[model samples]
Target chain A: MSAHATTEHAYVPGEIAKPNTAWIWKTFWVLVIITAIEFAIAFALTSPDWRTFRNSIFIVLTILKAFFIVGEFMHLKHEVKSLIWTVLIPTSLLVWLVVALVTEGSFIGETLSHMFSS
Target chain B: MAHSTTLESSSTPIYADAPRTGTWDGGNEPFKASYGKLMMWFFLLSDAFTFGAFLTAYGMIRHKHGVFVGTADKFFFSTAHWPIPEKVFNGFPGLHGMDLPLAFVALMTMILIFSSVTMVLAVEAGHRMDKADVQKWLLWTILFGAMFLSSQAWEWSHFIGGSEKGLLMADGSVMHGANLATNEYGPPLFADLFFFITGFHGTHVFSGVCLLVWCFIATTNGTFEKRGHYEMVEKIGLYWHFVDLVWVFVFTFFYLV
Candidate 1:
């Protein structure tokens, strides 16, 4: 069979079409806007409690950016549902692991600090 | 009559050299089964584990060492007493007397991020069978990767070259201001961990540059024309994006946190 013939056999259900450039461009601009906001939060904010506020915002925005890249740019949305879930499930688990480990580790360190210093 | 027919069929024995009808080969799922792309995914998965292990080690070390003196308490509710990332990374040639905070490293981050964008564009172009766009974007990606690597090298040299005061030593190992064996910028294990982790990442980037160069050459020579597809570009895209994603974690854990 010809190379083009294989498109008919693709595991994906929808038409295996190229992504819309205009939509991609729009998404890119949105990502840029979000990044700019992140920089502003990191640099411009001067509140005594800014770190907590900024960190929360940063994490949320980063997740959003990652979702866009994976779902849209990488065309994971068009793939078989099983494949999407297979990738996403593990990724989510890993993210959770990183957060938990880092937080717990910090707490332990803090406790150690108090123990040694006192 | 049935016996006679069977005897004739057996006598007319099929040739051993005849090809099978449903054999697995190049034609099976041709569009989606590019070897290069498959290899890329495998490479990415392995690379992800490496980064995971490094970050986990970092966490373990941080757990033991506690936080840096100026960073831990001062960094939570307020950014006030936080150890400035910029102050730690402000070295640049011809920019003497200027105290730039994380400026160069930030630029390097942008370079890697933008390179990822270009890599995706190249993959997209490949899908459209636009060889020219593939070549163009691949070249851009290569340039970005090279630039980022150079920036990282400079950062490392600045770090190891030491400041005017030099690294304070106690008991023959570098000690922080508080006279503690380790402080939050990560334990002494931190300096070692940082070098190893980033060095491994830099090696990947260097390899990526080589791959991009190869891909560029292949595109120019119309290798995909005969094959009638661009799966190689997609494969490389996976590797490039993985690098960028790893950096996001590094920036957060090592710099922000």
Candidate 2:
């Protein structure tokens, strides 16, 4: 760990690692392919009946893309398990918020539609 | 139970036995991460919540107002329902009167992803302590960032400048383009949210570009070399990746889904 005198905090960075350019290219390809698939679905699948299915596919793929970006690009996956958990645990609350919003928003929508109709 | 020991005459503190090797007892780095990196992670975590809240509210509003509930090509704009996003974002620059949907935004997404790749490369070059490679990759990242921002600006202007004829309001007025008060596309709030969310993300991207410029200058001057490490690049790389990550979701929710 080498500390820099210029920085006020004097951060001691961890490890002298080698560069992995191949991994960077691999991640780039994966992101591009995922985005291509998303575009394909958006353009090709145009049936109203497929709206929910299409949305589901997009959501799942977006989450998958998020996983790769966060895990590999951000280097969070290689961090110690404790550090990973610290980040993930707090973010899990977002899932709860999603669920709550869906339920509440639908209820509100139904109520508003009914009220305004009468 | 408190254990008492006689005070030692040595220079070592009396509480030296208080297990510090594998814990946050100040004897070691608990996360095995430097203080700066850890703080950056925490800052990003908080930032994630801010964005999460924005998107969640968007979702709620979308559900509340109700959507057009049709495929991209079959949708029509109306004030009573949420507009189909693809229809609103259909036009590409210099391709007026063409009904290409999601293509331009997809290009924007690719630009951001490419920039992210360059950012990671910069970080990797930093790991190798390769100054030339770091500067090269940072330059590419900054260029891609500018490209993305310019594309976004054109998109916003296209949306705002109105397309097709115009939508008629109940008050005998034609809402030609979008603003906080009204929009030709659909509900007024749709444009409002678009401006607010994308504007906020654009601000982040702009700030990120400034930071990259600073990092580029610092690299050119051999500041990190003198400091014996390139950890600053890694820190900034984390922020750049975060901006990309947010764009990923924005592209999904706003354009695709």
Candidate 3:
């Protein structure tokens, strides 16, 4: 194949020939703002009953961070829609498994401790 | 005759390098595979599984232990026996003798995350065919990565460099928190597990630093420039971002929980 022809054919349809740098930078700044908020929440909050609120906030922020990292940084957003789903679904499953296992494991530990003391 | 002439005039140009008709879906498919990117995705998938297993095992052990260690009464902050993560990681610049609490680790986390950003920037620069920007961002990423590794090294030293037992005795055997057989913190197993898990993570950071350094040198040497694409930066970005992502879970499970 001729070099020019090869180069021309390399352009995949629906792919942005050039990404918008301004949009990416804007998103990046937004992420930075969220991170600052996270640090603030981590340090400044003093409520005795803040655990639930804090955890929920952290989880939500973290998911948002993950979305930007995957969609923008990883360029997954630019890929085929099917491929994006392929990656996200399995990742969601793995996250669920981690939470479930950690909860069950902690429960067992508590039970064993109680039994030993009794 | 008129229809045929119009059709001939408007026919699309078929390049020699283009895949034969029917080889790919219709005319445009979104999922294009280059060898490197495909491999990166697969590697990331496997790594995800490994992390999931480790975290699951951690959960099991934590549950089985039942009692928290290093509570405020026994150590500092929080009533739970689980060591206060902030207290355990409170090293800070010019704050000697002050228990700053999770300050250093938080800083390290920021540094690593920022490096991930730089890595993506490098990949973006590559997509734009801007060699100088790619080089600049990759250098920044490498510097950030090195700073993180150095910080981790300091953290590890602080962890292991506390007063050594039996130093004056005839046999200078260093005693860790406890042996692997029996002790508080869930039968000494928890300590071993902690060391193994964090140590493994440290090794990954160490190796990642080396890879980043290698990539930096290659970029400086104009390797990516000659290759005509910055996909290599994107490839490393995947690995770098994965490291950062894993640390998120580690922080949640090991520190927050």
Candidate 4:
């Protein structure tokens, strides 16, 4: 504890911070636009095939929105690259795992029904 | 009942940060993250896994049920495809008996996403060292967050109060509200999972609001200004944004999909 120096009297600059009010507004608008598309798709679609297509679109848009919120709103984009990957790679694995498990689970359900129902 | 007794003068292994060797060697963050930020990121990752498990289980069960069979005439009252999330969460506030179909939750999602924007604005204000603006944005963020929690409370009440008397279950039995043994909505697991996942996410939002309250107070009290930086606000912003991100997934799985 004694080894650490105090930062109470640390340097201060007159510029404060690089105020990018424009960028923040852009991010807010992009999120709204994506959500607008999601609502539109939700109300407009009807058939099962189109339902599947709409589901894919919703998932893609969601991932896109998640990307923006995590990268920009959370400021992970400004952080060092290594730190960003440290969070992203494991999360990708998580998504893959969910997909694999759900697929296997559905197959098992089908197999079990075939075995017993007959 | 939840509290545990503290041990007398504990040290070494239980208290140690680890051996401090190799890639994670002594004092250096090679990752360039502060202790607080690194810990929050790891916590969020673990939490992501927990939510992942819940949603995956939901997918498996709902898929097993196949396409919805029941009539869509009565809609929310009559049972349909258990996998059909849009049918399940079709209630709207104030205007009861109207089949708005995901409209209420759509509003909830917008409320949450807007709060995330406010939180980001607060962080931006913090960056510029504008305490007044930071306080203003934090206040708005907290208000929106609380508004969301109240909306969730209303939704829960409507869910628990369910279809006046009761709805018909898969086995033709009538079940009311929800419990471990019975569920009016498809399988018993349906109601159970809804309560658990949304309940868990709701708990996090509640805590995030509390955190915002603290940050708001600290900012107003001139703590960040005195400290010469608003790193604390940034840390909490990460947390706030994470809560919003998880909700997006929950909304997709529970409502849209």
Best by DockQ, which number? 2
Question: Worst 10-residue stretch by lDDT in candidate 4 chain A?
Answer: A1-10
The DockQ ranking, best first, is 2, 4, 3, 1
Local accuracy of candidate 1 as per-residue lDDT tens digits, B1-257:
23332323456544444322232422244234345554555566666777887887776665555333443225421111234454466667568657665567667777877887888888877776766778888999999999999988887776665455444344455533221234334234555766888888899889889999998998999897567677677777877787877776676556554
lDDT of 2 at B198: 95
The CAPRI quality class of candidate 2 comes to acceptable
TM-score (chain B) for model 3? 0.75
Greater-DockQ candidate between 1 and 4 = 4
Highest TM-score: give the candidate number.
Answer: 2
Superposed Cα deviation of residue B151, candidate 4 (Å): 0.8
DockQ (C-alpha) of model 1?
Answer: 0.24
Candidate 3 chain A weakest lDDT stretch, 10 residues: A1-10
Across B1-257, the per-residue lDDT of candidate 4 in tens digits comes to 11122332445333353334334335455666667777888898898888888888887777665565444444453333463666667788879877687889989988998899888888877767778889999999999999999999998988787765587666777777666556566666778888999999999999999999999999999998877777788889989999999999988878887
Provide the lDDT at B246 for model 1.
77
DockQ for every model, please.
Answer: 0.24, 0.47, 0.32, 0.42
Query: How do the residues A19-118 of candidate 2 rate in per-residue lDDT, one tens digit apiece?
Result: 6688889988998899888888987887878988999999999999999999999999999999999999999999899879977888898898899576
For lDDT, the strongest prediction is: 2
Clashing pairs in 3: A105-B63, A106-B63, A109-B63, A109-B64, A109-B65, B68-B81, B68-B82, B69-B81, B69-B82
In candidate 1, stretches whose alpha carbon ends up further than 4 angstroms from where it belongs are A1-20, A45-49, A114-118, B1-39, B68-84, B171-186
Where is model 2 more than 4 Å wrong at Cα? Answer: A1-19, A116-118, B1-9, B12-25, B69-72
Could you give the candidate ranking by TM-score, starting with the highest?
2, 4, 3, 1
| CAPRI-style grade of the A/B interface in model 4 | acceptable
Local distance difference test values of all predictions, in order: 0.65, 0.85, 0.65, 0.78
